[model samples]
Target: MENLPKGSPKLINAWAFYDWANSVYSLVIATAVFPIYYESVTSSNGGMVDFLGITLPNSSLLSYSLSFSFLIVAFLSPILSGIADYSGNKKSFMKFFCYLGSLSVISLFFFRDTNTLWIGILATILASVGFWGSIVFYNSYLPEIAFPEQHDRVSAKGFMFGYTGSVLLLAFNLTMIMKPEWYGIMDETLPARISFLMVGIWWMGFAQYTFHYLPSNVYNRKPRKDFIFKGVKELKEVLIGLKKLTTLKQFLIAFFLYSIGVQTIILLAGIYGKVELGIETSQLIITILLIQIVAIFGAFLFSRISERIGNIKTLKLTIAIWGFICFAAYLLDKDNKYIDIQFYALGGVIGMVLGAIQSLSRSTYSKLLPETEDHTTYFSFFDVTEKIAIVLGTFIFGFVGSITNSMRNSIFILAIFFLLGYIVLSFMKKIEPVK
Candidate 1:
């Protein structure tokens, strides 16, 4: 493992630009505007229309489709990760996924009121698969780029840049859609569609910087082999790694359990505000903008705190804060006009902790895993747990909301997850990074 060139601004910028590129998908399509647009397009005029003689809210159908997409991503991610590792083509695989995702985002412009439901659903599934699949390889590259000692700072910096990039793009897109009159755009929807197109262009354009500057790994002891059999072998090795976690198994278990609450909030925060709290779409976009803006400062703050108190202590504090946030969500009024203020405040708190949790967690787990040529294969299990946690958390929220008809009540259940995870994490031994 050679050291990356110190103060190589191009290398750092290139790595960070990948974050910049992918975050557009997260900000524009996944979070702010598209879900609302999907609901609007699918809505009926208060009629019990039969789809195969079964009546359902268009929103429910959308949620179901989203959940199904997660399921497919969960199943395919590790397999694809294994294939990438075996072929030593993680970079190519990432590019393919990025292209698929960005193309799908741009194609959202074609989804009009007259578009078929299947078209929207198919697009969502393709985009989700690409987004989630690409992350496995992307995260694996962290250790390759930065040494163990530098992982925390470098990873945090990447996240900070990502949040900043997301905010910058979201600001432009929000202005276009929210104040189309000022921009001389006749139709608000046209700007919204153009916003999606911008995400694709931004993602495609910035990715080239990374591909140009980052050196490809050249150490190869074995020739390229059959991808199918190699993927299976890698999958078996991952399962074996999970089973071999004798002392650190408790830490992995805690991460797996607690991540459910973390992922649920990330995925559903915008939808919760728009649907349950009756927040206007523009207000919801502004709230997300605030999250990204505050998160930049928050990452720096946590980096300083971790320097003083250590990563484990900072993480413990973050878990405690998450518990309180979940409890606060339950207390917020479902119909309160001031609910957006509460959400904005909550987003601030989340911003303060998000980078710390992700950066520290990655560094901590990298220390725990064995040194292997197939590091990405093993890391795929970590990725799998994350996706599965998200799937389960979303499923739980949706199930509870459907049954109880209250998002607040469903949020109360998240506190239990946080508390249990905190307790589990407290018991695990401190992780020491490899020298």
Candidate 2:
């Protein structure tokens, strides 16, 4: 492939458009509608879910399933990313997972009742793997499409698009669930089922606009018959290279620590609100929407702040706030008179830092990567790092919640992770631009 010139507004926008395409899965299926739907279903069944012939608490089962999916992504990313780099087919590998994820989402339309519990859990796991697997390739594109200095703004733009697109679809879905009769649907579950269908359609349909413009085979490598093994070799090289990139290695350590808190919080916040705070479905949905709306502003606002304070400092600030959020969440009690108000207030703070930290983390890591053509392999490491963090975090959160019968205890554990991540970030030196 030709060496495409960087800083092309048209090209960069095309790349960012993928976020608008796929984020529906994040907000609707991963973050909102499905989790609530899963809980509501199992709660009606004596608050126990039958998982692979064993009954488990509904939250524990869901957490384990999600943790398993992230573990798959972590295992697959390194090898798959190597093949993509060696074959010069990064876009193809990305497209494969995008369709895998989107189609799996559409298949959720069949998950109608408790007896079909396996379908919901299996489909959710596959869709999650698809969503996260594609992200490895998608993130590898940042350094290729933009100069290092442009990384922050470009990364924030993608997230801004994501937050906006997901919120629009979620708002529409919430309306259908709140008033099903307006659509002539009497089936109590049909509204959410249709939302599942809509999310799949939205994800696949918008992605075409990105696929049409995104470059394929950018490196134009011609792989030999041994390309399969060549891919594994690519991973080994990155592992060796990381030893010299001390700051980047240090940043990943800090990122892993904080992500255990950040991702666990994002994944379980809905359940915590439902069971711990006794928040109604309507209030919980509204709070998530509020977080998404606030996150749009947060993404760009922190991007601007990073221009003055630099990425490391901005990230440290966000991590500090995340630690505060964890402690604040632990304090929320259902017996309180102003429980809903306090939860909403806490949601405001979560919204402020959620997108800021995420966008900055991706861009900051992109800026730190050394100049090389094996970007897919390199970013795979970053992707694997976070996915592994998710696995550990979710597993711990679920284990603690199941044993103690209190998710609040899980939140308290996450607070310590954030604190540890904050302390690690203090040692990171200012990074120089990759020449």
Candidate 3:
């Protein structure tokens, strides 16, 4: 593998390109089309599913499945990332998961209807694990590819790539779905299933550009026969390392709190729109598309803002807006006049912060790290923190919706998390990454 010098533009952009490759899964499958498809399928089947021998509402079942996937990532990343760090194989680990996720997404084409619900559920879980699992290693590369002063711009650049790439593919997907006749498809469900296959293909096909450019192992370390045990030892050492880094620990606490709300909102917004507000599928997807379009600007704008105000304040600003979004969401009901317009307005607001916060959060964590080569091990903690938060958030969303039969109730409760995050963030001492 060719080694690029540190902080080179080509190297940084190549790292960012992976976001372009993989974010289609996040937008198309996790956020927009697949959830709507799942909802329609379950709605036709009396809105119920039996999974693991327990009957659950279709929406709740999907949320629970996502929560389960996050749980898997949370548990597995620490070990795998430690191994990647020790063996200098982080890129390999990333490719393995990417292939796993893309293949699983392709298999979702087999999920034709309620009868193949297991295919849908199983594929959803595996694909999610693949996307997020690969993300841990991908994120670990940030500090390696960019100077500290440039982390915000580089991170935002990645997200802009993600937003732009995802939107283009989703636009294509939406056209296929809305106008199935253009493709000579009369089956209502077949269009969505085809979209699923395309998402898989898009995810795998586009990733090759990144894989081609990215160096496999900068460290050049070889694994021993006891690499697994060595990896576990590294995991233990990072825990001790975390205990010494007070600011990073504090930031993780705040990040975890806010993520419970932010992640849950991203994952469930489609369901909330469809189930809680009775939004039409086309309108809901269009609103989500609007968010992706807006998020590109949001990421670029906020990255520049972070350079001026610093990452922590930028994050606090984004979180404040998130708090507003949660409250506004709780206020929405199906009975409101011009409800679609209101939803679109909220989608616009979400767009403004969605990419900004996610990009900033990753860079902020990167900037705060004590100088170390075990970036993957350190970032595994970060990814684990996020995955655990998502797990809790999705579980709460599902459990509350199951009990109250209204996801609006979940929205109301999630706002409190942001408030707590805001308070916790204030306690983190302001420090410049490059000072």
Give the per-residue lDDT digits (tens) of candidate 1, residues 50-146. 3445667776666666777777867777787777677777777788888888888777777676345556667777887778777777777766666
With candidate 1 superimposed using the best TM-score fit, by how many Å does residue 196's alpha carbon deviate from the native? 0.9
In model 3, what lDDT does residue 261 have?
A: 97
How far out, in Å, is residue 117 in model 1? 3.4
1 against 2, candidate with superior lDDT: 2
Candidate 1: residue 94 Cα off by (Å): 1.0
Evaluate model 1: give its lDDT: 0.74
Which runs in model 3 stand beyond 4 Å of their true positions? 50-55, 399-406, 433-435
TM-score versus the correct structure, for each prediction: 0.91, 0.96, 0.95
**TM-score of predicted structure 2:** 0.96
Question: In candidate 1, what residue range of length 10 has the lowest lDDT sum?
Answer: 44-53
What's the lDDT for candidate 2? 0.89
After superposition on all C-alphas, the RMSD of every candidate to the true structure, in Å, is: 2.9, 1.9, 2.0
Minimal lDDT window, size 10, model 2? 1-10
lDDT, candidates in the order shown:
0.74, 0.89, 0.89
Q: Residues 1-435, candidate 3: write the lDDT tens digits.
A: 456888988888888998998999998898888987887787865798887788878977887788788889999999998888888888889999999999999999988887899999999999999999999999999888888888889999999999999999888888888899999999898888888899889888988877777878777888898999998898888889889888899899999999999999987888789888999877888898999989999999999998788788889999999999988999987898889999999999999999999999999999988877789999999999988898789888878887998888899889999999999999875755522
Residue 4 deviation, candidate 1, in Å?
Answer: 5.9
